[model samples]
Target: MSRWIVVLAALLTFSSAGAQTLKVRHDHDPWGKCVGELSFSENGIVFSSEKEEHNWSWGWTDIQTVDRRSESEFSILSYADQKFLLGRDRPFDFTVLEGRGMDDTILGLIQSHLPRPVVDRLPEEVERVDYEVNVKHLHTFGGCEGVLRFGPDVVVYDTSHAKDARTWRMGSAIVGVWSVGKFDLELEVYEREGGDLLRTRRFRFQLKEPLDPDFYYHLRRKLVPVR
Candidate 1:
């Protein structure tokens, strides 16, 4: 009987160990009036948001946290990037919409609006990069678009209204290697007639670590200024 009891105890201990759970975290945007959260586990990664008077949710599967250090320090590798670093404790420009939760929505909307072939030709890693859209007429749905490159090839274009223009305006072609963090992107807004260059504006921001559940609960209660 003593021998049987010992074997059963060992099995129970092993089963409990396999049931452990993982946590995730994220940064809050005060200016934008939104909250972004990230969670992770042995299963996969999930992203959620409660802001702008509406709740939005999205996620990515087949995600594994190959490396973990502390609450604010870790690295993740996914299907796209072989290596990605996460700094949860460290705070960056959390207010910037480019790196916020709406990224997926904007990408989806733009892809839906533009030609499918153009989006298909884009590099697979393009989705991993950060971007910003400056809207002039929100109702009209027109503004400037810019993409920041982590490897190479940065592109910026404009979708502005024109008096006699048949098509949308193509902003000045700014081509250069952009750093990983946030940057001031200068794109020229042009008119349809003679392709007249209108003006250039600099958009500023910084790139922080990716969102995770462990970090989200940590900062969700705290308040950070948007601007």
Candidate 2:
């Protein structure tokens, strides 16, 4: 059979086996705490999140990893075109560009781009974590409910602990990438407070593949939505 045909068959088989779910850790913002989980099967991919401080939870499923290129570039077909690029040697340059669709369409796009080897070499396990922090002005009232007005605003240190701060702060996304086999990865940190972003960081690690699919899934899903 041709390589493409074999890949398609493998994807079909994997999808039918059942969905595989992975956990993502987020520790970027001080005020916003987020943990994202994703599942993939023959049908496609699904993403769910457990976030504190938000009024409602969010989730999406039936995403396919249609195309895969090297460890850096791939494409998925969902709404417009979901593209994944790992840059020359800088995998931290990892980007998930959205096409035309609801905010949920990116998941489907990612599903359509997964490479055959990456899918075929599925690891038995995977793991990941993200951390963030935010400092915001706290509001307080003086007396009666009707007389409630802004009190002394203080900088409140918030992390994943707060159950009411789900909307991520601006410029507050930090990411870490891990490749299980050779252990190749990268870390990117962004500043989310103040009118101007004042800080940023990046790091790299060497890892191998047939790495952990679960690990990659966790990392990808944990990514803060860029508005």
The 0-to-1 C-alpha lDDT of every candidate, in the order given, reads 0.28, 0.31
Find the 10 residues in a row with the least total lDDT in model 1: 164-173
RMSD of each: 21.3, 20.4
lDDT of 1 by residue, 1-227 (tens): 69889999999876643422222233332333344454332233334555433332222333221222222322332333212233222111222233333233333333233221111112224333333333232223343222323212323222233221111111112212122322222222221111111122233322233323442332222222134
TM-score of each: 0.19, 0.21
lDDT of 2 by residue, 123-160 (tens): 11111213212222222422111100111211112223
List ranges where model 1 is wrong by over 4 Å: 1-25, 28-38, 51-70, 73-227
Q: How close is candidate 2 to the true structure, as a TM-score?
A: 0.21
Q: Provide the clash count, candidate 2.
A: 46
